[model samples]
Target: MKVLMVSWEYPPVVVGGLGRHVHHLATELVEAGHEVVVLSRRPTGTDASTHPTITHISEGVLVVAVAEDPAHFVFGEDMLAWTLAMGHAMVRAGVALGKPGLGDGWQPDVVHAHDWLVAHPAIALAEYFDVPLVSTLHATEAGRHSGWISGTINRQVHSVEWWLANESDSIITCSVSMEDEVTELYGPQLPPITVIRNGIDVTTWNYRQRAPRSGPPRLLFVGRLEYEKGVQDIIAALPRIRRSHPGTTLAVAGEGTQFEWLQQEARTNRVLRSVTFLGNLDHTELLSWLHAADAIVLPSRYEPFGIIALEAAAAGTPLVTSTAGGLGEAVVDGVTGMSFLPGDVEGLTSAVREVLDDPAAAQRRAEAARERLTADFDWHRVAVDTAQVYLSAKRRVRHPLARPDIPQRPLPGR
Candidate 1:
């Protein structure tokens, strides 16, 4: 099967897990003997001299980039114009795929889009080509802000998400928890959603299991420095954790809005000197740290799926995470990893200390985590499952007017 994936974030311009998810999914699909093409916004500071650029990266995979423009953005207004402009670029790329000698027989049997950022173009292309549309909602606008739809921009985003949910033939989410959220948000008007959890390639880490060491342990946290991410909670818990294991050190990797605030909080706790802020380490650096760290922590207040937890398991590092949203579904408490209540400083401290206090038991749990990763979260298995969804969507016959829920739009050749 041939597939066209539309995403606002891709390599060299990733904002979060969505970009990595798209990259791996497309790569695995190609390995499964399918032709895949990606349409995305050009990376920041890319050469904008070219109008429409299509670059063939590898066998069975190609990427199309449209120039990015942010001059119309305001401080606090809705970004509908920028979103639509990116959507228009995707529309142009979709049109190219339908033409001969343009994208080298790149026509797609299924048009799959990730999140609401690229929904407009995904819907337009599917309608124009009369093909099946598949949408994967990585996370919703309301979910990100903890169900607060306060401003006009927030409502606009939710409205776009609703339209996309209704228009698509098939919807995919990372976990059962996310599936429920999508259903509740769309209120019984949505198509049948398939719960296809995100996956990790364990081989990429190239790590081997190691026995717990007899020294000061390192606790590692990798994520954006934001309130919802709960990085500050980790900072607050560190002092309590240190009292038990005085030599324990915390290494934080990632950059975000709350970087300075987190630093201040560390100082307030008087554990500033023990905390090391490694801002946004690259893949090699991150993996090296993962291999050395005694435990990995993810304290997200709202996580659709915890990919980092899977990575920790693959690295044979004991995991500690807050059981919030899909995270509870991802990590089995007291089985694969330890869990704590979201934003609970004491619980977070105890969870980390569990691994620190008893190294042998933590090692046993980490081994169990690796076994679970092999059984459940391999990329090959996920790719095959995703292919099934594509096939099901492709087999369905679609017509422009067949779905009256979608808003009317001009056809490609009209």
Candidate 2:
């Protein structure tokens, strides 16, 4: 199968789990004897004049990273404008790749879109090529805002998500909770939605042996420092955790808009000295911390699927996560790892205490969680399931009544 994937984030431009998800899935697809082409963007601040579009082969997959058009659009200041500009560039590259003698004359049997960020280009390219459009709605704007789309940007983003969900021939979600959320937000007339849990490369994230520690018991939190991520709740629970296990320290990894706010929260809760902000760490640094920490806590209020939980599990690190959205499924409460309700500071403290109190039990749970990876969360299985979805989408598009009629215009710069 010839698959074309459109995503705003890919390797060297990874902002979150979505990029890593795409990278692993695309590589696995290539290994499965399928031709995969990824249409992505160059990193910000990259000179477009010198490298307008970079085409390279990585792990048997062809990646075409296009440079953003020279438009005065700032992503943080105006995300919608920046996204549209990115879509324009992607469409130009896709058109060029399809033209005979101009490029490789490559055409995809299916166009897979990662999220709403690349919805416009994905839709345009799918329609332009007269192929099936498969989209994976990783998370919804309403879900992120806890069912409130108040601001203009929030509403705009929600609308775009709805449009993408409706436009797709088949939709894939990472968790059952996310599937329900997507259905509640944009349903009844939406395409077929499949729940495919996010996967990890377990071999690369092998369990690490820890040495005896002497200092404070270390607790690690690895993820975006966002309100929805519920980092504040961890800081709130720190005082209680310290009372039970004295000299317990919380190390926060990853950066976001809530950095300063979380720090202030720690100070307000009188645990400022115990909380350490380690900022963002690369994969190697992250794994080092994961292996070194006493336990990894994921206190998310709204998670599509806790990929971090899988990472921690892969590293055989004891996990104490909240049962929020897909996290409920990701971490089987008390079985795979300790879990609690979202935003429950007391519960968070209790769960952490359980891990610190019974180190042997925690290790047993971590081993069980790691064992579950091969059965449920392997990248090879994910690629196979995704390929099935693509086949289903192809069948849907081949139906005479289901065929989409999209008007095409002259290519840009023609």
Each prediction's TM-score versus the true structure: 0.90, 0.94
* lDDT tens digits, residue span 1-414, model 2: 999999999997899999999999999999999999999999876658866789999999889999979656888897999999999999999888899885568889999999999999998999988999999999988877767666778778878888888888999999999999888888767789999999998888879755555687899999998889989988999999999889999999999988998989999999999999999998899999999898999999899998999999999899899999998999988888999999898999999999888888888898899999989999999999999999988524332233222212322211
The runs of at least 3 residues in candidate 2 whose Cα sits more than 4 Å from the true structure, single-residue gaps closed, are 209-213, 395-414
Q: Pick the candidate with the highest TM-score.
A: 2
User: Which residue pairs collide, candidate 2?
Assistant: none
CA lDDT, every model vs. true structure: 0.82, 0.88
| CA RMSD, predictions in order | 6.2, 6.4
Deviation from native of the Cα of residue 66 in model 1, angstroms = 2.1
Candidate 1 regions with alpha-carbon error over 4 angstroms: 45-47, 50-52, 69-79, 211-215, 394-414
For 323-373, candidate 1 gives per-residue lDDT tens digits of 987789878889888999988889999999998888788888888988888
Model 1 gets an lDDT of 0.82
